[model samples]
Target chain A: MDYFLELLIGGLTRGSIYALIALGYTMVYGIIELINFAHGEIYMIGAFTALIVAGVLAMSGMSGLSVLILASVVAVIYSAAYGFTVEKVAYKPLRHASRLSPLISAIGMSIFLQNYVLVAQTSDFLPFPNLLPDLPFLANYVGFIGSTEFIIIGTTAVIMVLLTLLIKFTRMGKAMRATAQDRNMAMLVGVNVNRVISNTFIIGSALAAIGGVLIASHVGRINFYIGFLAGIKAFTAAVLGGIGSIPGAVLGALVLGCTESFATGYVSSDYEDVFAFVLLIVILIIKPSGLLGHKPTQKV
Target chain B: MSTLNYTKYMEGMKQAVVVSLWFMFLTFPIMVIRVNTIENIIEWRWMNMLYIGAGSFILSFVWRKMSGRGISARKESIGAQGGRKFYLQRLVSEKRLSLPALGIVAVIALFFPFVSSIYQTNIMTTALMYVVLGLGLNIVVGQAGLLNLGYVAFYAAGAYTYALLYHHFGVGFWLALPLGALAATVLGVLLALPVLRLQGDYLAIVTLGFGEITRLVLENWNEFSYGPSGISGIPRPGLFGMEMDMHEATVYLYFLMILLCIITIFVVNRLQDSRIGRALLALREDEIACQAMGINKTMVKLTAFALGSTWAGLVGVIFAAKTTFVNPASFTFLESAMILSIVVLGGTGSIIGIIIGALLLILLPEYLRAFGDYRMLLFGIIMVIMMIFRPQGIVTGVRKTYEFHTEEK
Candidate 1:
């Protein structure tokens, strides 16, 4: 029972990270109607950025809270910028072009970024130092109950609540919703559609960056190609949650994360990937719109 | 791209200059390598002139220009809506062949096998294998409009099928090929049942996962697959109980491969003209429309996946025979991507286009050893360019039996 509880907790932790990344995929897909295949790469950029920031700070003898704060900020800013540029260069031009144009372009960009990193980083795995505050409470309750699990769940909840507040109340958040609903109408209402889209990429990418930092730090190893599988799983989570719905994406992420966690714990680890994909296929077969996704009714 | 409008007089001057430059570029290398036979063919500069200056640039230009002419001529032939359709038909008719003449040439060339080198023969064989794989995938992507990013999984499945069976039971090449294809077909149908409803990128992601899963399974399933170490020493195909090791030149195997190619072409061409092909085309053009037209989208799509995978399986058997080994390394996501590139690089629905696309792209990588690392980079750039200018595909206007095979909307 303890091991089962532990597995359950572990699953939710991974799921929360997936939920964050899924939000990015779901948001971009919602507004543009194009699968941002490179979204995963953006998540990758965040982790790599955090790695550099942490590595550089440690190298310069900055070790504690200051190093943590500096690394986190750098990761968020760098990821957001990368996301914005990716939208501008890869996706913006094909906005008016045929639907397939942007998709193919995104795939191309994804391959390019992956290869670029592969060349730049020499395909080696780097260790990420933990910058988390080693609170005694982890040992007393969280870690005593389950360490990684509680950290994941607690961090994810905090992030999710913060995200919920930001989207529901903030001015930029309102703009994003308006843009997603109808670009033309939103533009007429004086919403800067381009700004909103860019902001969405930035916001989504920032969350994914946070997820990346946590994951790499937790796993203690990072590499150029690490984001591919994580990115795909998150996208699956987004899809399973009914893409474009943030809360749904997060819920889906948790479910998927836990499912894989359990599968790895019980079934063969070799077959863990098969669970998420098979679930995706199953969900798609059962409800094409996803778990919380609305069915789009065609007028014609 | 519109920078070509640099004043008509300047454009005219540029064309003349380019034509002159092309001649000079073509001659300089040939002139330099004239002293040696191997140098003329194998020298880097000479090959570049042939690959970049001649093969890619010239071919791209010709196709672009032809498409331009086709667009205009199509306007003259029919209405603007039929422009694409008309151009392709005209292109196909123009490509109509005098097979008897080629057949005589082929018969005559069979006598001169002693002159061809072993390295050239091996290259030819590899090209043949890819052509088979490319054509098989063409059925799914070109005819059915289903993008398979994990085609190599099926290929791997077939190769493994042959390896496990032949090594264990001493099954012959001819028997293993079909059996391997059958196994892949079963997997394809099973995969299709779940993934058929997915469109485009969702489908791509699922297929990608599917391929990865197969690879992971192969990598980890040590008891059955021997894990990453792979199965080795699988025997080569013998001709009618005669061993070919003592025979000079792998002439018999080449002939067998050519025969396979002929059969593939015949089957695919026949299928293209059949009712089933029309249904697959309907699914490609629009799923809703196909359903409205009374086509069973699921069955047709499953058939497509099965057939396409079956082809890959067949090619894998050949691959196993040639390599005399089987492993997970030979089948990867990148391999699937490469096959998909061939289909895209060629016009999706055109057989001749796919054939040329497969031959040129697949062979270029093998023959040019220096540009190996940068090949993938260049391939990505080319894909971007192809998507931008000729989203339809090179040689896209070629005739297809699909014209006569169109189902009612």
Candidate 2:
């Protein structure tokens, strides 16, 4: 039971990070129908930004809650900028080109971003300062669950709830939904589809930034290449959840997280990535529309 | 007239501004770095960033003048004008300089090893391998219009097949080459079978996943693969019964590559006119219409996958033999991207185009090695710029005209 609980907690915490990143993927995919391959790089940049911020703050003799909030805010802003630029420069031009062109362009952008970071930052892994505050009183109640785990879960829940509310109620969300449903119809309805797309990129990137900060702090290290694997895994999570569905992304991420956790715990960790991919293939084979996605209505 | 000229200048200025802003955003992250000096100072090159922006703006202005229209206009002209003389085709058809050009190229290939240093010959050898890989990928991406993002998987499959066969089963390189290619083809067919229903982006993702899975399997199957340390000391393919030095070996490989290239081009060109090829072309244009016309979609797609993977596998064996090593690291997503870029950059479906594309993409980075770390950075940037500026590729493939077949019809 203890082992199971530990696995479950670990899975949930990891799942929350994947869920945050997956939401960015699902949202962008939902709106533009382009896999923003550079989004992973965006998360990576966010972590780097936070690392820089935390380093600067620490040198100035600041730490704990204030430093975390400030670093996260800066990281979010930087990531949002990157997201906006990537969409405009890379994706927007090829929106109507052959299907493969945008994808190729996205991959190019991803490579460019990766190399950009490699040139700018050290290739070696740099330790990230743990920003989660330790509160001793809650230790008894939440036994094996670390403060970092709680923070990650809490942050994800709060963000997911807020995002749900925004999507369900806000005008921007309505415009996004409308644009996603049909770009032409959305245009007719006077939704600035370009603006909506840009906003989607910004919001999605900000969310991914949060994931980056949390995962970096949790792992206690950051590197230039962390984004690539995490991005692929999160993308798998998004696809497993049904690419365009938000709730499905979260659900898929949790499932992916648990599977990865169990695979690592029971089986050899080397095969963990293989298990996720196999799961993806099996799911895609069985349900092409994914667990929550609707069967796409084909028009003659 | 004066006002119009002024308006044009203003428009050009506006474009420059926009381009400058774009560059600023793009290079923001790259221009700043944390130097690990005594104080850990943040290195931010404001002047360098601004200069790059200005340089890009000026380059765009120059490009606008050279191209003689807006960028969109260039794209429209290509789409609208189908009969524009493709240089290679026109030269060959006109029977003027093309045959001699071909002779010169062949002569150059024949004598290149002796004239250039061993290092240069080695580079050309690697470039030739890419040429073969590029041609194979062109059949799938260019001919069939299928986006395969995991092409390196087949390459890996081929490489590993040869390596395993040699290491365990004691197969000769000559015999193993065909078997390795066959293995890749089989794997390709198997991969396509599972995702038969997928289309477009979904198909792309599935292939990407499969590629990652293959890599992971290779890496993790330590009992077989030797786990990341990689298998080394595989015997090099011999020429006749001679034990050759490095230079002779490279030259031998070059000639072999040329023969393989000739075979691939001849077969692909012949296939281009075949019933199956036309069916594939039809499928690429419209899957539904092709299916309605009684074409077997699954069979056509599977054949495409098979043919493409076969070439990749052949090259894989060649690569493994040349390097005498095999590892999962060599077969990353980036390798697939490089191959795809070659196909896309060289006009898709064009044989000569693939040659040029493979040469430029492969050799450009080698030549740019002087730039050190910026070589790959430039590669990525060039790829994006190429896609944006020339989606049709450097040598836009001439649309096929079925002269002989049409006469019979």
Candidate 3:
């Protein structure tokens, strides 16, 4: 029972991170139908931004809570700016070209951003400062969960709820939905499709930034390449939940997280990555639309 | 008129401001925050950022002016001199000079090693390997219209097959090469069987996953692959137990790759003109419509995977024989991306185009080593710029049509 709970908590923590990053991927795919491959690099940049901000704060002897809050905000802003530029330079120009052009351009952008960071920062793993406030009282109540895990899960839940509310009630959310359904019709109805797409990139990238900061802090070490595998796994999670669905991405991420955690706990951890990809292939083979994805009707 | 000119000047100023803002944001983290040392000391280079911002604003302004007038002027001239434009197009396409061009190229390639240094010869050999790989990929991506992002998996399969066979059973390079290619072929067909129903992006992701799986498995299977130390001491390919020296070996491998390149080009060109090639092209353009016409999508797609993997596998064998080492590191997603870029950058489905694309891409990075660390960065930028400016590719392929004729009634 203890092992199961341990695995469950660990899985949920990791899953929340995947869920956040996957939300960015799914939202972009929903709006523009292009896998914003550089979103992973955006997540990496967010983590680095947080590292810099936290490092600066630590030098000034600021309180941990204030540093965390300020760092997250700065990271989100920086990452969102990257998302906007990537869309305009890499994607917007090739919006009407053949399907492969945008995909290749996205890959090119991903390579460029990765190397850019590698040249700008140290390629070796840098230890991320743990800024979570240590609460002695929580130790007695929570057996398996650490304060960091609690914060990560708690923050993710709050974000998810807020996101749900935003999508459910906001005018921007309705416009996003309309644009996603049909770009031409949405434009004809006076929806600013371009603005919606840009907003989607910003929101999605900001969410990815949160995921980046959380995961980097949780892992306590980060390198230039951390986002590559994380991005792939999160993309798998998004697809597993059904590519365009928001809640589905979170659900898929949780399931994937649990699978990875339990598999590492029970099986040889060497093959941990193998399991996620095999699961993807199996899921794709059996149900191509994913668990929650609706079947796309062909116009023929 | 004076007021209109002022308005134009204001618009240009607005454009420059936007471009400058974009450049600053893009270059800020990379330029300003130079995290140089292990202690994580923040090294700021504000001057570099300023230069980049200023340079981009100037370039953007110039680009705007040139495109504003140059494009329309060229279009009008081309419209006026239609016959001259057609003649120029034919010359540019190499229709008139193709035979002579082929002869010249063949002569240059054959004598290239003797004229160049041994180091250059080796680089040329590596470039030729990519030519074969590029040509193979061109068939699947350019002709069949299938997006495969995991081609390196098959390349690894071929190399490992040769390595394992030689390590365990003491097989010769000559015998193992074909067997290794066969192994890759089987892997490709087996992979295609389950995922043949998928189209476009999904297929790409699955293929990418499979490629990663191959690498991961190779990395983890310690007893078989030595787990990352890699298998070494694989014998070089030679004739009748004659172990040639390094120079001789270079020439031999060069010729072998050239032969392979020629065979690939010939086979691909012939296939493109064949019925099956037509079927593959149809599948690429519209799978449903082709299926309606009784063309078997499954069969065509399988053939594409089989033939494309065969070329990759053959090159893999050559790679192992040349390096005398086989490791999971050699086959990465980057290798797959580079090959795909060759096909995309070259006119997709253009035979001669793939060769030129492979050479430029492979050799440019080699020469750009003088540019130091910015080689790959520049390569990535070039890819994006190329896609934006010419998404069809640098060398567009010729579209061949088969006309149906009815006998006189």
lDDT at B141 for candidate 1? 79
Order the numbered candidates by TM-score, best leading: 3, 2, 1
Evaluate candidate 1 and give its CAPRI docking class based on DockQ. Answer: incorrect
In model 2, pairs of residues that clash are none
Q: Where does model 2 sit among the CAPRI classes?
A: medium
Candidates ranked, most accurate by DockQ first: 3, 2, 1
User: What lDDT tens digits, residue by residue, belong to model 1 across residues B1-409?
Assistant: 3565656546555554565455444233222221121222222245434444444345445544655664565456456544445354455545354355446646744643456676666667777777788889989877888877778889998999999998789898889989999988998888888887787656776787788788878988899998888999887887678756623426666666777877888898888878998899888888888899999888899999999999888888888888888888888766887777677766677776676678777777666556755565555555655555555566663445334566899
Q: Locate the minimum summed-lDDT window of 10 residues in model 1 chain B.
A: B29-38
Q: lDDT tens string, model 2, A105-181?
A: 88889988888888767788888888878868669887988888889989999999999999999999999899989
Return the lDDT, model 3, position A186.
Answer: 97
DockQ comparisons of all candidates to the true complex = 0.13, 0.56, 0.61
Per-residue lDDT of A71-148 in model 1, one digit per residue for the tens?
888888877877886786567655665555566666667776676556444466766777666666767754535454
Which residue pairs collide, candidate 1? B88-B397
Q: Could you tally the backbone clashes for each prediction? A: 1, 0, 0
Candidate 3 lDDT tens digits, B54-133: 98889788767755654565467558854333332354466667677777988999899999988899889999999999
Query: Who is ahead in DockQ, 1 or 3?
Result: 3
lDDT scores for all predictions? Answer: 0.75, 0.86, 0.86
Q: What is the TM-score of each candidate's chain B when compared with the real chain B?
A: 0.74, 0.90, 0.91
